[model samples]
Target: PEGSSLQACDEAARKLTEMILKEDGVASISTYVGESSPRFVLVIDPVQPRNNYAQLVVVAKDLKSRKNLEKKIKVLVEEQLPNVQSYSRSIPLGPPTPYPVMIRVSAPTDALAKEYAGKLKQVMLENKNVTMVRYDWMEKAPAVRVELDDDKLRQMGLTRKTVASALYAEISGYSISQYYEGDQAIDIVFRLEPKDHQSISDLGTMSIPTAKGAVQLNQVAYLSYENEDGMIWRRNLLPTITVNAGIADGVTGNDVTNQIMEASKEMRNKLPAGVTIEIGGPSEKSEDSLRSLLGPVPAMLVIMLILLMTMLKDVRKVIIVVCTAPLGIVGVILGLFLFNTPLGIMAEIGALALIGTIIRNSTVLVDQIDQHLAQGMPRLKAVTESVIVRFRPIMLTALTTVLGLIPMFPSDFWRGLAIAISCGLTVATLITLIVMPVIYCLIFNVGNEEK
Candidate 1:
């Protein structure tokens, strides 16, 4: 309710955690006092949090439970702490980040960015799908600000450097000098001894050097615990405020992003000319990954077209063979849907491989028909023979391939790939055996020559 300080933050976290743990499906609750990580496996470069930032991480037993648990938590929080601001989140699709929904507010100044970031944070919290609203850049940490008085330093017959070093030596110790115990040299470290350094208020009583004697630090320097947001974050040489939050269960990152975009659309018209808002975190990354995958598709299709035209030497024949590949894609999509799998990178790779297999089957049938035509067989007879002859091999190839990949079908990591390949091949094989010959005849005007 008040300013952010460590003690205040911890007390708030415990209270929030107490409220969240009461939910039926909640399995565990992790409370953060000023932006510390819940995970213990590893920590990269870390930043010291300044304000009374806190979080209540509520994890439920399962998906069905998680949604209900979160909804209950929201209701409890709303009923009890309506004055407090909070953000929520659902399961994220991409890799973990600082926040699932990070709204980056870039403006001319830290204050300006922070202002917009606060506004955006409220906008996000308004959406039921969003949660855990936080912005560290705007947090004014409780800290002592000490500035040396120039006149006081000169009157005390002390230099600013000496007084500054003395202050540092009192609190955070530094090397006085070094000593040697044999060939190895050891630098001597010094600071205010245990009793004198016990409290932050001791600084008022701490002494600094003067020409005549020692003077208390308060005589030479101004001291007070000023609330200041010390950390200044810059991106692209412009100040930025990152407002982050989590998503609610039964919701997706895309859904949250879409809601945010809709909610913030009016903000765009109201925003200053130089100011900008960028939605980031997992949602943005997911879109970028998807766009990257789709970006190369047109080029790949062009290359495929050129290769097919070069190899077949006939536009009509190449078109017929290439068209059979999509027969497999229908199965690919169907299999993914049935298995409740996302059409991710693994599925795309599987689809690419599936296309090759489909084209191979179509090529085999078409080649067989061409051979028959070269021998002067009737066009319809050629088509019948090609279908009959190629059916066994196409069926056998697909069946064997599907059987081989069936072992991988159950694994989550490989499930999409397995389903795409196995199902696509099976469907495409039938298309190649039963449909390709007809397409071939229609394309080349071969089967109806006599008719």
Candidate 2:
């Protein structure tokens, strides 16, 4: 609803709690006003500068996923409120934002922004991965339209300020004076008693002074209700509406983003001139972060491979070592799957680190095999001896690395990262030790050539 108030937000939150009050794992729903969030504003003051915004902070019983419960709460709120025809729910996704998808629709005017945002939101919902969708650029609420007649004002010898002051004093109220008691100070407010200004008709009875003396405000101005922007939002001085959504469980953020882009061609035809859409929020952030990290990946690989080649002087051995490095992912994939952990950026970084350690260990084992080969030992014996000689050292190195990350598994924040490195290194180390000899034998035909 456009022109919604702090009170209206509270009412919605109140009803949301009423609907989910009996649901299991619901602790409480705490609501506050004017912070641009529907639930849980993380600001310092209890209240900030007045805006038509607020949030409903919901606490659940321990570490429970209350996504379904939140969906039910939205359905109830929309059903009860006539103006609130649509509703969506999201919890704290923690730091950054809770919404899985946030896209910005910008246009020269509010109407265009609203139209584009609505269309984009609809397209996003078509993708099954997206569970909930809402846009901040619209308002369904009706505003109190107060218009003063200019001719009547001139005839009555009155100015706009006097009538505005009277209306402000009568309805919005005003601070008359302040009293200082010791070190404390308090405002003494004065205004028409609640009974006198409870309704529009009563407010019209307010008297404003003119050159000809006092006259009723209603006689000069007309008061009515009209639909308007229920909420106002802007970005970089351009009219923008942010469309956000709650994603379904097991759905990758990238998957939903790909759907939105694929649907964009058709969606663009519906948009008016001067309206444009920009991908944002988690989807945008993920793309950017991955791009930044991956930019140097090829160069890093080339440099590492070059260094390994220089040390071994054998391209086949270098290729064998690199192939064994990625065998660590077997453990990484299994660990996350067993723990039900989502693969995020942290996990990607951990994988990179694990690969680096694997290569270093492989290089050391390869050096031992080369040393024995230089002494004219049989290729088969040299490969067998190398494995036995490197096993204890490689195991101890992998053991320390895994032990260091042991505490991270129990942590919510670091678990994804720790699981990737710890499990990947453990599995890769064992595989590399056992498989390197076979890789060396196959690549060089070491035993056959020696015979």
Candidate 3:
């Protein structure tokens, strides 16, 4: 993943680093450019580590910032990058987990840090599941300040550089060479005592030596608190104020997100016309995926009905098979409820799989009973006899299928499928035993004498 690049990769890396550091929640940022493409690495803080699983890496330049740069990057990478099957704005290269909201706040000075910490703590305590909130950039209170007025420095025949060097000498101290004692070596440096530079008022009164004489800092320059000046966090290319929240064990990411959305909505409305609020996280992806999986169900049903008509040919036989399908589905629903599992996309797909298998079994049983009656056996006798003969194979197939699926129950990928099929088959087998016979007798008078 490393090689020399024709383009100035170092320049790109430096610029990207500068851009990311300006944003909040980012603890540290690094970049690497190889023969294939550039890679970005970011360390971010969320409300909880469990809620933020993936390390988001993007190859395209658009993802480098909050601009819609994905499309442009896709085109460029495709044309320039060799053997590229695809390129993306961001790819999750780590383990998957629920998504987290990004919250940002800036307090450059130590006094502001205390104020900001207090407000953040109050907000976090109001929400039960918020376990952690970390600051991206922090500035401690200034222990000393050295100030030089340009006019006064010019009149005194001394430059600001002279004043700065004198202050640095007093603070950093002069380092002496290492001295050996036995097998150990130690170095010495001289500076003011800890108490001499501990307070703002103390720093203001400290004396600075110059060629003319020693001068107190308060006589020449004003001293006060100051912090690093820069953007701390950003969103959509603008400086942002934000924080992330994690859900409790029993609650869903969506549930926690909804609460945050509700809390922020009133505040968001009060903001000026240029400002806006957006809620994003893993819940959005979950909702979208589920919708995609369920959206095709109705269309699939119509196709299935058409196929059933063509295959079964008889309306009565088709109706019986269709009727039995619901019993299987009802069983699946009840099973999910009993197990306390959410009916996710995988579960819905499992139900679809069960439908096909159940229809096949029903057709086999119903067709056999119809053949027996058409051959002139008494209707009740035919029903009972058909069930007796077919019962072993029917039960055996259902049991074998259920047993085969049992191993998959523990896996996330196939557990839903296993549960749905096992429950559907069990219910359909029972309904076929009890309901099919009653339906046959009501529809066809095989046991009754001619009128």
Candidate 4:
């Protein structure tokens, strides 16, 4: 807590202010807390009034470098303000380099906002994962002040209203004329060149032609900078500043998140007592969805088995019929692989459908064979007879199912499901027609001969 980067940030601000004051021509330098960085306002005495501009604010890579550069002020702060705290050198739980890190510093007043921003900017520059950081929330743009002199305007014989009208007319043009050429229509308007209004000085120097003579705008009015008004828009209702870092090409989101957590932990230990850090993104959503889907798999398998038993009745018959379920599954998996379709909810639903249809086909054939055996036919004859009799219906049903699914294969959403089902039904039907009857006959013979 004593050596927190925040403390370093505070020290950096004091140092930066001193550095600004030390520079020649600087009339005044002030630092204020900002939502993102410390806001520095520098007033410079103009050597030439015409070329005078606001002070330049230079941001460092991190707080340490800023503090290092402003060493003179550090000594001054220690001498003058003994109670002022300097941030720790290390972070307790700081993330590794190239991981995104976000920090929130709340100020009770605007003065505090400006003060903290200066410190935050310094700390961010020192941290490695902090590649790009910004704080538009606290950084106010200088206001453009156009001071109109009544005496100068009276001398020019131009009223304030006319001056205001001319300024508006030159900056924002009004549409004047419209003309048509055959089917095309075009509009034309009058306005000054774009560069004429690019800066405050350009606006000050603009000449307006009136009845008396051309009057230079600067002669009537002076321009100065002012802070922009209104609070900045924020995402998720937090005066949040984000520091984005680019992960290396091979790094995964999880890896980057882990690295950031590690670094943040280190940073946290060094943080002043009250500071806290939180990390979140798309990775959280993925983890939740994966856990929800994973928990139901066993229940789904048991349900499918129950359904197989209910439809087939006999356990042996159910086994023979359910064996085709895997053949269908193999077909679906192969279809997914061949088409390069990643298995998703729709594909899984397609697999479930394939299971039902393939089992039905196998069940129908085996049931018929059992019926023939129950009617007193020999086991071998019953199987041969069942296959010969069921072949046409099985082939017909499979062909119809394949034809129905053919139209769905071209659609991206349905194609995966369609291809899986179509291939599964085709392969499973073939396996069921050949292997299922053989299994049925063997089971019946084994049981009957033993009895």
Candidate number achieving the greatest lDDT relative to the actual structure: 2
For residues 1-451, could you state the per-residue lDDT of candidate 2 as single tens digits? 4455667766765665676676777887766565643323542123233445555666777654466666666666667665653434443333465466778898988878887787787788788888778775565666577899999999998888878887788777899899999999998888878788657787677788876678888899998867776557777877888887767877766667767878887777766677878888777877788789889999999999888888889899898889888888898998888888877777878887887898888888889988998998888999899899989988998999899999989876688899999889988888888887888888989868878
lDDT of 1 by residue, 1-451 (tens): 4354467667666777887776677888777677755454342223355445666666789878987876676677688767556655454333656666777889998778888887888788899886567774676656787888999788888998897788788777898798999999898888878678555568778988777989998887878777876677888989988877777655656567678878999986799967999877766877787688778888877898888778778888888888888888888888888877767667877987887778877777778878898999888898899888878877988899999999998775688789999987877787667778778778778746857
**Candidate 4 lDDT over residue span 1-451, tens digit each:** 1112334545656654665566434444434422221222222112211111112233445655554534444455467545543211111111222223334444334454445555555655554544344443454544577778889888888888988888877887767887889988887767899877778878888887779778788888888877663354334443443333333333344455456556456544654433334444334543554567567767876887898688767788777776666778878888877877756555766877776787777777777877897999977777788889988998898899889989988765688778888887877777777888667757666446646
Candidate 1 Cα outliers beyond 4 Å, as residue runs: 1-96, 175-189, 193-202, 249-251, 287-303, 428-442, 445-451
TM-score of 1: 0.71
Candidate 3 ranges beyond 4 A from true positions: 1-95, 98-243, 254-279, 337-340, 378-386, 435-451
What Cα-based lDDT does every candidate model obtain? Answer: 0.76, 0.77, 0.59, 0.60
Better of 2 and 3 by lDDT: 2
Cα RMSD of all models vs. native, in order, equals: 6.1, 4.7, 17.2, 18.9
Q: Estimate the TM-score of every prediction.
A: 0.71, 0.76, 0.47, 0.38
Residue 241 CA displacement from its true place in model 1, Å:
3.0
The order by descending lDDT is 2, 1, 4, 3
Model 4's number of clashes is 43
Candidate 3, residues 233-271, lDDT tens digits: the string is 444555444444544445545556566556655654554
Order of models, best TM-score first: 2, 1, 3, 4
